[model samples]
Structures are given as C-alpha cells and as structure tokens.
Target: MCVEKTPWEQVIDFHGHTCPEIALGYRVAQIAMRELGIKPTPSAELKVTAQTHSCALDAFQVLNHATYGRGALIVEEQGQHNYMFEYTGTTVRVFITINPEILDHLVIPKDLSSRREVQNATLEAIQFLLSSEESMFCSIQKE
Candidate 1:
C-alpha cells in the first residue's frame, strides 16, 4: 500500500536544506554593505539552521537596506559561529553552521581604512536602527 505525506512534512523537508539560505544570506549582506558605502569582506558565513532558517534572507536584506548610506562591519556572531561583513577588504574566513543560540554583533575595526567617515556612518546606522520599530532584531540593548 502507498502512503501520503502531510504538507507540513513536505515543507519541513524543503526547509531542512541549508545551501539556499546560506547563499541568500551572503548576497543580502553584500548588497547591504555596498549600499552603505562600505566594501564587503571577502569572507562571510552562510548557513541554514532552525533559528536562522525562517528569515535569514529577510534579516540580511533589511539590515543592509536600513544601514544603507551608512558604514559599519555587520558581524553576525551566534555563539562560536561568526559572520563578518567588511566594507573595504576581502574576508579572511567564512564559517557556515546550523546551530541556534548564535548571536550577531557589529564591529568597527579600530583602524578601518576610512576611520572617521566609517565611524560617522556606523553611528548613524546604529542610531536609526535603534530608534526604528522594525529594529528589534538589530538593536542590542545594554543590560
């Protein structure tokens, strides 16, 4: 006898893949950095996991657009996993993962190529995201 599979099962099975999510995430990060006037780092992390599967692409795109016209290295670090987005050089490494509990952080190198300009742009982006209602994910409040 043949058995039928549920729709949820099918959907889950489709989402179970990781390649697509990672690729899209990387692309979104690249576009966002470019728009912000910062060069994208050659290395980046792109992975598909339960926590990052749902809106990985959307998050990347939104963050990129929201930060457009500004400058900052969007470093998404979830736990030990890290993704660095640079604005003026190639990335040194790229690590992909499917683990939850990973965190994301933005780091502005002390000696960035364009220190003054990049700092100003980074500040602007941070302020804008912090103030916007849609910045829930982008803002990291100090405890």
Candidate 2:
C-alpha cells in the first residue's frame, strides 16, 4: 500500500532533506505570497530575493513553483533568513525568526540538525508557530 506525501514531505524530497530553515521557509513563503497576492507560477510572476542561501530557498520554489531559471526566484545572500518578495517592483519583506528564549521554552534540543529528529522538530515548530498567539517568531515587514 502506498501512502500520500504531504506538501512538506514533497518539499523534503525535492530539497534532499528537512531542517528548521526549510520549515520556516515553507511558512514564510506561504504567508509572503499570500500577502503579495501572488499565486504559484510556472514562470516568473513573483521574484523572491533571499537573504540566506539554504534549503529554505528551495521551499519557496518547490511550494510556489518559483525559480531563478524561469526568473521567478532570485537569491541574494545576506547571511540571514530574510526574504523579500517583488511583483512589479512592489516588495514585501518577510523574515523568519525564532526567539532564542523560545528554544528553551519549547524544549527543542540544541543539536536538532540530525535528519532523524529534525523533521519532527520542524513540524513541531511550525505547528506551535502557526497555532500560537505568539507572532514574534515570524515577521512580515513591508518596505
């Protein structure tokens, strides 16, 4: 019997693995594109400039079907997980952040880079982030 893969599962497959950045990217991209009123594209309707070069960038492309090859995804490394979305030159900055304090609060281990438990951590973090009233974890700044 074959089971279906979730969107995040598909993202992990295309992305080679899963991590906190990837989870953060999935949420950030979803919110950013929704905020900008941009839909999934086979071509360039939305251009994403990322502040960091990580698996996070791949999530945007995988989830929204945006990519640099088609001129849809443009990555500008700033050594951070900040993202800027542009459509017709109108830009919105969406940054994914987790309060360092929250780590202890959530009890997420420091060495969560292991693929075995990383995916669990990713999902747990994502769930808490979206479900919690706390909005400090993710920020959407308009510029």
Candidate 3:
C-alpha cells in the first residue's frame, strides 16, 4: 500500500525549501480555517493577503490553495511577514503576525545571493523556529 503525505509535507516538497515563515504560513492558514469552521480544500472561498512575496505566501498557496491566480490571494510588498486570511461571504478575517524578535536571533549569512548557502541556513533556522513553539514567534487573531 502507498501512503500520502500531509498537506504541509507536500508544501515543503513543492516549495523546494523549508523556513520558519513557511511553517508560520501553514499554521496561520489552519487557524483561519478553524475560525470559519471550514474544512481544508482547494476552494475559492478563502482569501489570503500577504505582506511579502516570500516562501510563506507560497506555502499558503500550496497548502490552502489560496493564490493570486484564483483571485483569492493578494500580495502587498510591505517587506513584512504579516498575513491576513478572510473568508468570503463573511466579515471574519484572521491576522497572523510573526515576531521580529525571533528573526533577530537567527544568524543570516552575508552572501544571501548564494542559493545553496541560504537554503542551508534557512533549513537550520526553521528547525530552531519549529522547536521554540509558535507562541514565541507568532500570534494569530480573528477579527
């Protein structure tokens, strides 16, 4: 028999890399869905607004099927990692904020242009971010 990977596992595969933001995006999407009492699916009802065009947005698209092409995801280049998810047909919106303090603790290499080096550093940082617990690095609220 064959086994299928979970949505998040598939997200990591599709993203070709893992980082704290990706994990945070996945968690944020879940929190939003839970708030709306909706099941996870590639539906057109959920809307995602991201403040940056980073791996987190990709994770949101892959895991939750919220993307620009479907008119459900919007990206604003604010250089921040804050995310907001709103379900259509309702006024509910869930905002997720990533703590800058957590990023301050990470040691980013100077040569960010090197793909291999950056990926390695990102993987390591993601591991630490995951173990540190969500409350330390992010906060989610429904509005």
| Root-mean-square deviation per candidate | 18.6, 4.7, 3.6
Position 51, candidate 1: lDDT: 24
Better of 2 and 3 by lDDT: 3
TM-scores for every candidate against the unseen true structure: 0.21, 0.66, 0.77
Q: Write the per-residue lDDT of candidate 1 for residues 1-143, one digit (tens) a residue.
A: 87776532333343453233333344334433443443244353222122232324344434433231233323334433323333334433323332232122233345657767666755654443333342332322111
- The Cα local distance difference test for each model comes to 0.36, 0.66, 0.74
Runs in model 2 lying further than 4 Å from the true structure: 1-5, 38-44, 89-134
Return the candidate ranking by TM-score, descending: 3, 2, 1
Q: Clashing residue pairs in candidate 3, if any?
A: none
Tens digits of per-residue lDDT, candidate 2, 53-117, equal: 77677888887677868877877776666677766444444444545444333345768768768
Q: What is the lDDT of residue 45 in candidate 2?
A: 67
User: In terms of lDDT, which candidate is strongest?
Assistant: 3
Better of 2 and 3 by TM-score: 3
Residue 35, candidate 2: C-alpha displacement in angstroms:
0.5
Candidate 2 is scored at a TM of 0.66
State the displacement of the C-alpha of residue 1, model 2, in Å, after optimal TM-score superposition: 9.4
